[model samples]
Target: MLSERQQLILRMIVEDYVHSAEPVGSRTISKRSEVSFSPATIRNEMADLEEMGYLEQPHTSAGRIPSQKGYRFYVDHLLHPFRLTPQELFQLKKIYVDKIDAMERVVQQTAQILSSLTNYTALVLGPQVHENKLKHLQLIPLSDRTAVAIIVTDTGHVENKKVTVPEGISPDEISRFVAILNDKMRDVPLQHVKSKLYSEIMSELNRYMNQFEGVMSLLDQIVEVEQEDRVYLGGTTNILNQPEFRDVEKLRPLLDMLEKNRTVFQLLSQQDTPGIQVRIGLENDLEQLKDCSVITATYHIDGKVAGTVGVLGPTRMEYRRVIGVMQQLTELLSDLLTRLHR
Candidate 1:
């Protein structure tokens, strides 16, 4: 339990360091109107704070910086949420108003806006196909040997891929196969398509089509390909703007981790459970992110968890503002999805 003075001093140092990205001295804090102690008294309290693990003294500096434990304590207790400025709200509103028709575009644009607003890297995971019910399926022949396979989900997501047509399969036969697939798989979640395809849909396909095996294989490819998670990133280079990341060699691993879609997908999806989650410093468990912090907010469609939006920055991040912006955007994203689908 910290004394009121210690708490006040810690909060002031955190706020100052977040703003300036530099160690804070007791004299600098003593000058604040809210601080009533002399620099000598404040220095003693700071030493105590450092001994208690809330502060760290860099080499040769008589100043202190908030340790990860200090940041965690400050965020959980001292942080206060602030409302967005009218200009910030207006910028957010403009994107939704202009791009409401396409949820994917809205998500992509939202990522860009988040990075621009925070000057940090932003990643938005698109709604999972497994959560969406199958809506429609179509096969359009582009040539004798090739066709385009299209799958539409209940959430208005359209996925298409070019596939080679099996020999001896006519355009009429392809249409019939698609008709059968739509009839059996309509309204099924994408994740269950593989099991349902082999267990139930296969026998039905075998009954009418002589080339059922070929059609089944093609449909399997379509369903399997669509299951890959999509991650939209914005301002990946913005990490370069942070003082801690000035060393390109040190920043390489983190940037490399971001480039792996599967890795970023796992990082974001693991925290998609609920609310705004904060992973500070080594709490992320990834060595590449040991000096960083991640704030994630899950966005839903009609109360069902759809995806996540996240901001990644140095551990010295302005937590209150970054958290507030993420929370507001998450709410708006949910509302936009609900209204768009309606």
Candidate 2:
């Protein structure tokens, strides 16, 4: 365990270095009103800190910077909860006030808001059908033998299916099928929609309709959920703004990882117990992510982990502020998505 004075100094160094992007020296530490230690005494402690592997002295400067170890220690022990300023809170609230309707739009705007506020790359994984409950289903006629079936979920995910309206089946019959299905299956888990449709609703529809089998087949096809693998990204180029990524060689793999959707999905979906996960330098398994930190929060539907939102930046990240932003977004996203179908 570090002494109280040492812990205080480490915290100061991490906080100052994160924003300034420069090495911190004992003289710099001494200038703070809270630090009573002289520069010489602080320098002695700094040398001890470097030996302990908590600090690194760059060859170009007499000042020292926090090593990965120092950052981890600061995050795990010395970091305090950062409260969002009133302006920050307003910016977050504005996302919901915009009243975006589709899940795609909501996730898109969320990615934009996050990257704009933090100036870090943002990734948002939108929930799939299994993570949502059925809100409504409708059919729109396109031609004499064709129609479009649209499925809307509680989380605002939309899936469209093209239906072949049987030669004899009237539009009135199609309308009835939609009404009955909505009445019976409203708010049912999407995975169970097929089972319930086959077992319960099928028998009732058989009496009036002659093409019952074909209509049921069409309904099954319409509800057969497979088209919802979506990821919204923002500020993909923002990493260039960070000092650590200024070199093209250092930025290559990370930029490559961002460009591929499947790889990003895998990265964002690292199932850590739920809520927020903070993976510091080298803690994340990806070779390209060794120097980066990823902070993710799970947004849920009916208390199940449905999707994730994350911010990626260098290890010298603003953990306190970013974590606070994640916490706020988690709650806001949950509320906005949850209230949609209700």
Candidate 3:
């Protein structure tokens, strides 16, 4: 248990370091009106905090920085949520007021806005494919050799791509497969669609269809579940502006992970349970993010988690403001999705 004075010192140091990206020393903290302690007394407390693992002395400098444990403790206990500023509120509200019809565009814009608002790299994970129900499937013949495959989901997302029609398959065969897919896969979540097809529809296709192998190949192409298509990122290069990331070695790996960590974002979809989630320093699964922190909030459609929106920055992040902004953005995103579907 921390004494009131220790808590006060830790809070001030965290806030100061977040703002300045520099180490915090006891003398700097003693100057605050809220801190009535002498610099020597405060230095002794800081030494104890460092010994307890709440603070770290990065160099020979007599300054201290919060350790991962310190950060976690501060977020869980000392952090207070603050309301968004007027300017921040206006920027977030502007996202919905501007017309956007496509779900992808909405998500992309959400990520962009979140990044600009927080001045940090923003990550927006679009609705998980497995969690969304199949709404409609159609195969429109462009020619005898090719057709456009369109798959619609309950979340109002549509995926369409040109697919090759095997030589032996005719338009009638295409219609039959389309009908079978819609009949069997409608209302089934995307993740289960392929399994259901193999289990229930394959035998029928093989027995009744003229070219069984060709039909199965076409089915495979049609249901190729897009696992990473939904990830939307904004301000990927924003981290370069932070002083902590000035070293190229430290910056490169994190940027690389952000550019291609689809699995990381997919796992973020599972954070459906409410409230802001804070992952500080090594708490993150990716080793690339060993020096960073991620603050995320899950947004939903019709109360089912559709995606996650998050900010990635150095562990010295402005927790109060970033968390407040994320909360508002997630809420607005949910409301926008609900209204779009309705």
TM-score of each: 0.90, 0.82, 0.85
Query: What clash count goes with each model?
Result: 0, 0, 0
Which pairs clash inside model 1?
A: none
Alpha-carbon local distance difference test for all models? 0.86, 0.84, 0.83
> How well is each residue in 1-342 modelled by candidate 2, as lDDT tens digits?
888888888899999999999999999999999999899999988898889989999999999999999999998898775777888788679766766876657777889888887789998887766656788998999997899988888767787878787777787888888888789999888788778877887778886566787677767777776532567898999999999999999999999999888888888877645877888889999999999999898987657676899999999999998888888887888777666635
| The 10-residue segment with the lowest total lDDT in model 2 | 221-230
Better-scoring candidate (TM-score), 1 or 3: 1
Off by over 4 Å in 3: 130-148, 152-156, 162-167, 175-217, 266-272
Better of 2 and 3 by TM-score: 3
Error of 1 at 194 (Å): 6.3
Candidate 3 structure lDDT: 0.83
lDDT of 1 by residue, 203-278 (tens): 7767777887787667676776532357889989999989999998999999999998888888888775879999
Q: Which regions of candidate 2 deviate over 4 angstroms?
A: 102-104, 135-150, 161-187, 201-228, 302-304
- Give per-residue lDDT, candidate 3, residue 85: 78
lDDT of 3 by residue, 112-136 (tens): 8888888998988876666767889
